[model samples]
Target chain A: MAGKQLFIVTGATGGFGSAILRQINLLYGEDAVIIACGRNKPKLDDVTKGFAAGVKHISVDFAERQGLKERCQAIFDLAAGETFSAAYLYNNHGLASDVTRLAQDFDDSAEIEDYFFLNLTSFQVLTAVFLKNFSGVPHTCVNISSKCAVVAFPSMSLYCTGKAARLMLYKCLAAENPEVKVLNYSPGLMLTTMTENFHNTVAVDSTKKTFQAFKEGNLYVDTDESAKKMLGIVKEGSFTSGEQIDFHDC
Target chain B: MAGKQLFIVTGATGGFGSAILRQINLLYGEDAVIIACGRNKPKLDDVTKGFAAGVKHISVDFAERQGLKERCQAIFDLAAGETFSAAYLYNNHGLASDVTRLAQDFDDSAEIEDYFFLNLTSFQVLTAVFLKNFSGVPHTCVNISSKCAVVAFPSMSLYCTGKAARLMLYKCLAAENPEVKVLNYSPGLMLTTMTENFHNTVAVDSTKKTFQAFKEGNLYVDTDESAKKMLGIVKEGSFTSGEQIDFHDC
Candidate 1:
């Protein structure tokens, strides 16, 4: 058996997931296998190619509940039936949108429901699947929550509610299953594709200007730095099973 | 202006809501206007009949976002036009269900979405509407959370997640709006209609047995006792604005 660790990263094509996968490969050498997962196959492939040869790509639309159980089972089967030494079930995938615009012009329930599905329900289904399949002790589940989870910002009601709900879900699950090391991580104010899109689409010029000011220096951190900090936390195992860790401190 | 205080109670037909409303009416007298809000108008009327003529009934479907907002606005308009003294906004509405069973047996996402709407989104929307519209200063927002909000319970995932999310929402809102006194309260286990239904329909005997033990003096407090304790806390006003008060302590 290979002594190297296996990491399953969801939203691998996304900013934080991509950065974390790259950093893990850099740190652990070529022996690490990264099961990079996302709904978009082409993007997943594009992101995985830069990684070492052992890094494999998997495409699964977790939002679609149909056949999700079987699909996850297949992934577990493909992992050679070996329990992962460590897994970063990073729920980095989310709907990037301008909440101010939505708040102004579109307060539709359907739109809110769509964001909730992508951001919250998918996380719930994935957590249930992983908890059932992986009984490995010392397993870590790292959820990528936003600052919105802690504070309610105006205009981003959908994103705020979804992220907040997901954080609570993980907290409850972590409390229930004390054996699993569940971390509710707030990757504070990363100037990634998501935040860039949010900035571009912001309706108010003042709000946009404020975001730009923050993006220039104080409010943003690169994905690589976030990933390094998070991985360091995991390595140290300093947190209790259900503790929340923010990126600013990480 | 009447010397009595005004109270707004959501889910007024529910056990805890009714109990709290009764206690408030007894303490404050017939001049107090208790706005009983719920979908079941007839039940609310029946419950509040003997209490006071000042009691008003507002039939509201909590899951209907637009309808809820409109109803809340109407209530605020009525209260403002009357120039009531102090106001207490008690968020007592919620739905508790066996989430594991629902997830396994039910395929309808609409059902799950409706559950969240009633239990989570309604709290957010209602609180926002009340805070925005009501001019009553030194206003109190009392949120009735659950023990499951703090501790994870099997089969009650929906309730757990909803209450937990709302608790955090109240916390966030309290932090932002320091002028408003927000109370996140857990009434502990109560022998409500919801619990009775839970005991009746639970698939597992162990769950039913545990609930029976809880119901028969093991894990629950009397609704009247819990309400009295909560009212005492409200009267004292010793707790900080963002503090959470669990009635189990009383």
Candidate 2:
């Protein structure tokens, strides 16, 4: 039996992630089978609340790094002895450093590890598990890359480094596995909770400029529209494996 | 005083790192005070033994992941109440994963973390400390990058990802601090303990080909030559900040 067309959305509760999931739900309705993975219960519940059907919320904290191995195993073991196809895995979850300014970058290793944990380590662990469990399946993993991946800003050093690692990791995975497609999808500037949180918490001068841009609606894209465009790109099947596509490109 | 003209080299016992150190010793003698940092006391001793007068060996294991903060503190504390200028920091320490094949990739997170720890984490920690302690000093930090940083290969996923992170981290640092120039110097392919260890330990088909190339001298530059060329690039004052200069380019 062909197992359900599963679409795994990490950071499902986040603004961009939920937007993507909402669109997927609209597109697929009862046919939608999404594994909405996130940390917070209320936020996860909120994201999946409007879904008509085929939504499963699994609360897994990438930061704490608990239950990841068991979770991935359970994800695949349930599809044991069946032809299961994971259509897509969206590595949408990301965390910017609490210490945003480069000058004031963390001397503490634990604090710095937080950025690597969320951005690079967690994504890599998940991707490795995905590849191991579903090598036969043809699927695409869209990494929600950022401007930091390509350009290094004044204060966003941690973000840039992590996203850069994510992008290169995608490229390596793409080269290794022909069946699995990897796209480093830099979403440009979007008004997301994560981005909002950066400006709210850090209050760096550069982040202040970002806040201004958001207020002016001059720098960032509409989150919903950008999500729609991303999905549209996926649906169109135009992206080559291992290619980096920006929101404007879409 | 010129503050002893300190040049700290991590992975001092390693081929590339030692080569760089040896060249510095030959060029500057007492003028260039080299701090050869590595894990092995004997190897570090061997590397710096023949040096005439300006060599200090500091043993700090990256795998230990302990006392680094204190060690770094002690390093700069020696320069307290004295005028000092750090000329260069060679972040040359590196570690390769044992699992060479992507199909046989590490299931254990610790193994994966090890690859990242030695390659990216330790480097970043030291760099952060370096920049913090010596922000006023003009210095260059050369990361001993690999072809893996730019090009992806089968079974080298862990290395590629970690090195890519290192490259981008360097870029971020260069952008943030004008005095601290960061170079992701991909030495192309080099005959080093790490590269030799890859094929020697894990005999995958892909790595076997690399081994064959190394045996026949078909691919890779000699490690010593590459080191000299890298030093030459620094000496020439041609490199722009945040530049990725390979040995071939130099």
Candidate 3:
């Protein structure tokens, strides 16, 4: 048990994040221990309680600098420990733009900063920290991306551009480091807070229509289904590093 | 003429930026006014001195937010003025990462933040500003990218990821707005300050080897050559919006 299988999850309180945690537990059972990270401690605790292998809840605000660095250090220390395991990191935290339209009178600069920080910068930092600190256990990372990375849409500039950066980051990591396996997975349109809460997220008419369509079942995938599909990719061991597996394709 | 042709350029002090400015002047002469923007006031003035139409040198630090916002607003105000021409905003500003390896002892957070700010945020802010303030004259944005955007690289993570964001941003812009012509051009190993200043820039062995190869005439295109090739793209008018034009291919 020296090198146990440990799965590290960010955004563990979110729909897809929790689903992925559940799936990992279901598949690996007692073999997998989860390090579930999120801002909401109570929520993360609630979500991980039922899992058999159990979860180590890490309460860290990714948006805050000190907290993020501390959390990252903790994770690195864990990875470098004697009892540490082969790690699988799922970078699942992200949010859509504050406004659907760029022309909005609100703080566009702040929005852009937030989007890049949350989606690209933090991920980059964490990846760097992880890769630099890895001792011997096998490592893999899955970056939760969107189809917006492939097809940039109107009113989706911030999300589109940020997700695009995320995909490229994963690609670069996989290409540069052969030892680490990485995946940029677009789980399709999920019925998560990012999609369903768009009524509160953006005020523009164009995006509102799109969100309406999502609600009306014109398009969207359930989180659990995609989570299972993603695991299927891992099970086959056929996913190459830097593979971008879309939900529809799976 | 109340509404003539004005080419807006960022990083007006750099090699490719200056070359493109000179090329535009050489081709269009008095017919094209250059809104040359850069940090160095004296350099910008010196560069634009001989041009007939003259350059509106906007000395603004891109990495600094307050100055950037003020300068951007000023540029928009100038563009909206009756004297301003049918504007063409050329986003030519980009910085190679300060170091080659991302896993350095130096501040990775600060490095990532600076790269995103200078390369992506400023470009994005300017684009949003430009598009939102447009008054119906032909406008095209040429973003100076690199082959790194297409190919991910080790030690070039910051540039690679940022340029990837830039390319995707152009794609999104072209997709969303049919009227705005956008080109993401990879200059293909230009012999610019970005290339020649590598010894002073990065301390990694891999990058040093690549730079040494560049120094040995094993690689790198001349700025003037790439500039001429790029102008050919603009003159040909066959290049589609959102098209990625590479120097060798062109």
Candidate 4:
């Protein structure tokens, strides 16, 4: 019998995260073992309830720095001794910056450290553990990057910095490991809770105007649609591994 | 008489930092109050001693998270009650990554956190405090950025990520504040202590080969030459605000 595919998705309860999960189930059906990770147990359970493939929910708060490595290892332990044809890690977890504040307003070291620990450090550690644990498996790593990764947005310094770091991290990963398939996918402007907060709290006039246009013009990409496109790109696997492929571009 | 030109340079003991200090002295002479910051007391003293400009040394360790804001404030406090026609901050302090490690090798959360605390968080906080403390002054913020900020190099993930984040932070700062001048300058591959370490310890062959070529060909940039070009760009102020001007681009 052919081996089952392994799929690990973080932020599995968020809008794009859940959409990616649903699409994974649809695409792979019973041929995959899907490990869904999120902080809220109830939400995670809801997200993984009806998948055709085997689903395992792992509750994790990325903000909690202690025991993070062990937690990441435990994620791989879920499929211990089970052989897989391929393994995929969807690094979709991230947080939005405080849109009310500009870069100059972030003077507190502790606050800035906390923000990076959750967004950049945790993200890197998780990907590292995943790659180490699945060293022998054919691996595909996807970073849910954003337009902010390449461009600056007023009042979104933290978010843009995090995304840019994440994108560069994946690019380095791709360059170092030729056998690994790495994709930095900017899902475009999706209408999620994060965007809602950005629209409401963004202090800069120019940024607020862009969000307003996105809202009024209904230009926000549907989460499921964007997720599907990302998966399609993944399935095709023709992209240059380190290159960033955005939703609008493809 | 017109006010003095206030110049603040961090990592003042390092190759590029010292070059910048010398250039400022050459350009502004006694018209500049040059604040030189570094961790080593003797090195700071050596760098600032005998400069044509009025020089002040502030010993600071960016890695120490405690009392960071106060230290940043102390930087601006050195020029208290003194007027200036223009203010310039050369944010040159940064550490190169452990080149023996790849992106996947950075799984330890605490270790990763420590790296960013020194590189990104401290960088942002210093810039923030500088902007806030010198709000009324005509401020120019220079991020001593690198080619790694825009491209990923194997075995240099942490350094690349930090540079990328810093670049994005400055870009956001420029976007949010039109009145404040921000420059991300990529001083090309300079013969410095950091490059020496990179050459000796880099694990990736392709990256190591590039460093080898630079060494054998004597292609490394002179720190003073690059610093002068950067200062020339700053003096001209013709480049678009927030634009990344590379040493080679000019």
Best by TM-score: 4
TM-score of chain A of each: 0.86, 0.88, 0.89, 0.97
Model 3 chain B worst lDDT window (10 residues): B98-107
- Per-residue lDDT, model 3, residue B229, is 84
* Better model by DockQ: candidate 2 vs candidate 3: 2
Residue B9 lDDT in model 1?
88
lDDT of 4 by residue, A163-193 (tens): 9889998899999999999999999999999
Q: Which segments of candidate 4 are over 4 A away from where they belong? A: none
> For each prediction, how big is the interface RMSD?
4.8, 2.2, 3.0, 0.6
Query: Residue A37 in candidate 4 has what lDDT?
Result: 88
Across residues A182-210, which tens digit of lDDT does each residue of candidate 2 receive?
Answer: 78887777777677777676535765676
Q: Model 3 compared with the native: what TM-score?
A: 0.90
**Which residue pairs does candidate 2 place in steric collision?**
none
Per-candidate chain B TM: 0.88, 0.89, 0.89, 0.97
- Off-target runs (Cα >4 Å) in candidate 2 are A1-4, A49-53, A75-86, A134-136, A201-211, B1-3, B77-82, B134-136, B200-211, B214-217
lDDT ranking, high to low = 4, 3, 2, 1
lDDT of 4 by residue, B77-178 (tens): 998888888899999998888989999999999999989998899999999889876557789999999999999899999999999999999999999889
Q: Candidate 1 or 3, higher lDDT?
A: 3
Docking class of 1: incorrect
Writing each residue's lDDT as its tens digit, candidate 3 over B1-250 gives 4655878888888798988888888877888877888888888777778787657777767787665655677876755555554677788887777554543232356667777988898888887777666676777888898887877666666677888888888887786677777888888887777776655566556666777777787677878778878877876768988868898886
The lDDT for every candidate, in the order shown, is: 0.69, 0.73, 0.75, 0.91
